[model samples]
Target: MENEKTGEVLRVASDEERDQAIIDAGFIPGWIGEGGLRPEPLHDFEPDTWNWETGRALLEAAATSINPRVAERRNIRMANSAAEKRTSLNTIHCSYQMVAPGEFARAHRHTINAGRFILESKGAFTTLEGKKVFMEPNDIILTPNWLWHGLGNENLEAPAFWIDFLDDPLVAALKTIFFEVRDEDYKEMPIKEGSHHHIRWRDLDLQLEDLVPDPNGRYGKRLQLQTPSIPTMRLYIERFDKHMTVNPVKSTANHLFICAEGSGTTKVEDKTFNWQRGDVIAVPSWKLFNHRASINATLLEITDQPVIEALGWYRETTV
Candidate 1:
């Protein structure tokens, strides 16, 4: 048989006895064939869009039964529907998190880098290094590896919600996952102002108002968030005018996009994902995708492009 990818050819074994002997010796001859090696990359996870309305209801239903004191967190992992996945993506994961009124999840730190994009918050705060960073809708709060952080919703009238994106899968594959919990109380943590860790929505929105699309017209009005501190992922916010459609491209970067405002539709290969405020869409590496705003909209994208680029494996092609 011909193996064009590796430029090798296979022939019938001239010595079955020797092959049997090799097997008996706990060895498989490399000349026979290869199972795991392939010519091109095969992204294992499926591209999927998770709706806020659907996830919100499920989280609401589970709120009463899910006790943060025992469960560690009350969040819904956005597990990919394909491959019977336990994570949202291969290298990264996203979860829908809810902090019920009057609930407090204790402070802890882990080797996994994580951040959250607030969807709704009347009164919710993340205690970062013993300081409370109040969460406002459309804000992004980062908790890098080994940063002691906890969450609480002291507002008695309503719960707080957010979408957390983490590089836990990458750490898991490297067998470097470590976590620890703090036994101390977080009730007395003081509020922090002008924290570099919090990216206020009001500020970003004001900035996006004056920006325009790429010179190549590949995307809508876009701004790349500075990220020297976070090496694994890249964050960007793109604003689209009503009924606008831009160029589609495929690249070797897995992406997760959260709808921060208005409504839109994203086309990923053969799939069409209709999204509204608070919805999230997951796109696997190398899939052609583009977006169109039914109304003026904003999308916050978190991607593993940095990791891919650091490995010198990043590539792209316009579709």
Candidate 2:
């Protein structure tokens, strides 16, 4: 028998091998043998179930059936997420998240375009663009590139859950996905309470009235709500509830939309697609499209138009 820990070796009968000798000495074999297999890498188990198109569809469908009121008061938990191949394109990332009553997710921001759709929660909320909008289970929120945002529980008794999406490829491509923490735990400064920078669900309708038809024929109806001058745009619930407007966007960059409430249809080129709460639609660069709501709806739309314009690559046309 041999005691490796104490550097002592004892000779046993030639007929007894290492295994038998250890048993005779009342000691267990703790070391792994040479023939044992090693563990596999995590990339080997990457997700095979989701693609960009399918993932977006599944998220939209799930959001439509969620109960906002209950989610607000109760808590929900998110399951593990699987990755998709299209992730290589546009450096996009997607995941699901759920939270229960009394649980809170930390506030954060990055240089990517981050979008979220409430999966469940009645009184949950997302503070973006300086406004705290109650996150009805199906509502959608947008955290544009380099913006500060946070989530909260409005109803003390309810839970909340939502999905997160980011243009990871763009950030990775640019090699600039920097994140910073605020000293106050939240970035509640730099914006005024009643300023245009802050927008709520109620502000949707008021903002829509400000949309004027396109003076040039480049778009059926074009309203540059936000630009480099503003840096952000807000479409409140009221504006989404009004008559569906068809505005053509001549794209130089990708167009992103987050459904806040209700359902709608979008005409992309020659095709029309139905959209509901929590749906995140991404129109690729240089595409022509128009949006219509079935009923009153609220939506937060964003785009890389600023990036294109800055690079002198933006152009739009309307017929």
Candidate 3:
């Protein structure tokens, strides 16, 4: 056992006691462990919304002053206070990052796969593995594991911001994390000759209209937009019509839901949360939850289901 507040590891007398400690901490033990899954445990995270408007205000304040460590070579600016932590699950990390006009983040490579959901931006581009991809609102960009990547904002008057999602926690937990900073002398690297500029292109209006809900759907209707680039994570959009409701359901993997459009109410266990455009909510694993949309709602769903399923540990049960 470890004391989170004091950062001290607690020693237990026996392996059984250690297993019990982990169970008390709200997690199922690994396959090789003595402690197994509990049919029902208290959900670790409740449904809640993080307002983007509040986040943007914090971003503006952070822009007034910069941290020397982060601004030394990479002149990029970010709203540290606006970053969201995955309190529900430990596998994924999410944050709202901003880059000011004429600023650039220095190139770096790491073993963790990362992706960004473009929020609002113009004249911004991300270079990954020697290919430059221009970014726009609602677009998604991915940087494969261990690929060299960097971002720059060329817009003269406007700043670019996006929601970043990464599997850094999972990589760290497995003790397979690796990182390398690019040489300062080689800052302006050239793009690869045959690399494609964009990995994914989406039209939200057309996608919403085309994604019809099934009469016997389990969780309303969702359309997956992520390709098979990152094996450990999954991204998709769940669409709900006005007054529609998704019945309670539980899953083996935890979820991070971002309200892309419209308004809705999400109920997890006994708690309920209201959401609007650009709001984010974290849902823990095996939490019985339901949703009701006052108007048509589009929620960007990020999860680690793919990784759990690949390892034959994925489970789902409708309540």
Q: Which candidate's TM-score is highest?
A: 1
Candidate 3 structure quality by residue, lDDT tens digits, 14-122:
7777778788999766954445576565443444556667776676667658642376332222212223643335677666677778777767888998787777778
Task: Give the top-scoring candidate (lDDT).
Answer: 1
Per-residue lDDT of candidate 2, residues 51-142 (tens digit): 22354445445543553333431222221133433441243444555444544445556776666656677766666654565565544566
Per-candidate local distance difference test: 0.89, 0.51, 0.71
Ranking by lDDT: 1, 3, 2
List ranges where model 1 is wrong by over 4 Å: 1-39
State every prediction's TM-score relative to the real structure: 0.90, 0.52, 0.77
Report the C-alpha lDDT of model 1 over 1-319, residue by residue, as the tens digit. 3223334433333567557656776999666755567766788799998899998999999999999989999999999989779888898899999999888998899999999999889989998899999999999998988889999998998999999999998999999999999955666667899888899999999999899877786889999987566789899999999998988989999999999999989999999999999899999998999999999999999999999998999999996
Q: RMSD to the native, candidate 3? A: 8.3
Q: Count the backbone clashes (under 3 Å) in each candidate.
A: 0, 26, 0
Compared with the true structure, the alpha-carbon lDDT of candidate 1 equals: 0.89
Candidate 1: Cα lDDT at 108: 92
